[model samples]
Target: MKNITCLLASILLAIVVQAQELKLKPRKADALGGTAFAHSISDSTLSLVAREEIIFREIKNGNVPSFLRKFQKIVSKATIDNKDYELVFFVLPDYLAIGHNDDYFYMPMTPILAQKVANLLHCSLPTRKITDLIDQNATLKLTPQPIPPSKAMTTVPVFITHNDLVKQQMQPYLSQHANGALTVGNKKDIVISNKIYGETTPRVVIYGWHQLDGKPIQPLYNKHTNTWADYSHGVRLVQNTMWLNGKKTTLAKILADPLLSQLLSDEGIIEKSYYPVFDNY
Candidate 1:
């Protein structure tokens, strides 16, 4: 009696374990994002209960070779809306079977997915070289070599100005980002430097130009001069401007320049501050 009771318990445990194995089924049209009905199967018995439209004969007959079968549960083909589609299943292993819902089996990964599943199954997956993997009709193109770094810069120049105070304030900022050497000289003196310039044209930043007492200069028509005087020059203390690439430009314009944009980005400037203005240009 004791031996018989032990045998019965073992059988019951086996039945419980088998029942725990995952079974995936088709999701209805409403849930499939209007694509098509889908289903998954790991056993031949699935054919008996699966819908008639889900073609299962290929999987049930073991048409797919063992090597391919080790990765994914066999693939079954179906026709919906006159379009052909493939259905694949996920099989839970015997050791730790778990229940899964329909969505879990909807879309499986491509080539690499099979390899991952094979690894989980503790099976040896065959490897194919790139030459073997490429189809006869497919062509592989090599990437073109990049332009030499030496030719990245196009022009170089030395800045000579009378505003020593403003120059002193901007020197550190310019020196840090200058791909070429930063040369400063008096209005009458010439400073020469042997520094390689990058592809971008460099600029000089001038402050408090076309205005008296270093005040913020606005673009206004001077009636006496009868010309657009202050409009071309001046940087305000609160509303500052800079000479970008040798042109007197506003901060908005400086951020728009592509090379300056990259430079500002490299200097740890946040993108959101300038991205909106840059997008328009």
Candidate 2:
């Protein structure tokens, strides 16, 4: 009985020693942004040092494309509950953007880049379990309605072509218009490009023509720092004002005319004397 008691005491001492040794180490913070840390899970500890070092090495080795590197920015870093985390933002060439919070990483890339990152990290991507829960709990009803007769509709195609061609087309109207007036297509393209380049003060992305559910939507990228605004409404309101009795006008004519600019300024879409500010950081 004394031998049995000794053996149990030894086992307990060993367990206590192991528990004391299991500790998390603070990792080096990235200069651009991101704090490195060791995460303890069950019997194993995962180090971000290995993952981060690999990324930097690959980048230095020129493994990542130059275009992708241009949009990569370390937005911020923070320490929470004795653990450090970094928020890195990336705007891909394909217009797929990603950002992260402490609890979750949000990526519009969905299956493509998200899967690739998951593979690199040797982790599985998280599914929308909350969405599943909502669907399971909620009652959905489907009702059939009478189908209306389809009417023949004539659609006018809008073209965004060469700059020279656009300038040439607008020459007739240019003499009457202001110097800085831009066509509808030009305005839309510039704003979308600005979002991708992180030029916007509170980054905003304009959906491609009829991209989201056949309707255009402008969504803010930096939701944490920026308030959600309906930019789509402002864009549509300006476009409607430019239209003459719902008839589409030529790009050159629109650019050459001061009426569009006046209307846009009046509607608060564009400032009276607007200047584009480029963000260097």
Among all candidates shown, the one with the greatest lDDT:
2
Candidates in order have lDDT scores of 0.22, 0.23
True lDDT of residue 153, candidate 1: 16
Please, what are the lDDT tens digits per residue for candidate 2 over residues 19-135?
Answer: 321011222233111111111111123222333343333323333212222211112234445555332221121111111112111012112222233333222221112111212
- Which number leads on TM-score? 2
Enumerate clash totals for all models, in the order shown. Answer: 3, 1
Model 2 alpha-carbon miss at residue 94, Å: 13
Off by over 4 Å in 2: 1-202, 205-209, 217-259, 262-269, 272-280
Off by more than 4 A, model 1: 23-29, 33-111, 115-281
Error of 2 at 16 (Å): 84
lDDT of the structure predicted as candidate 2: 0.23
Candidate 2: deviation at residue 53, Å? Answer: 24
Q: What is the TM-score of each candidate against the true structure?
A: 0.15, 0.17
lDDT of 1 at 274: 12
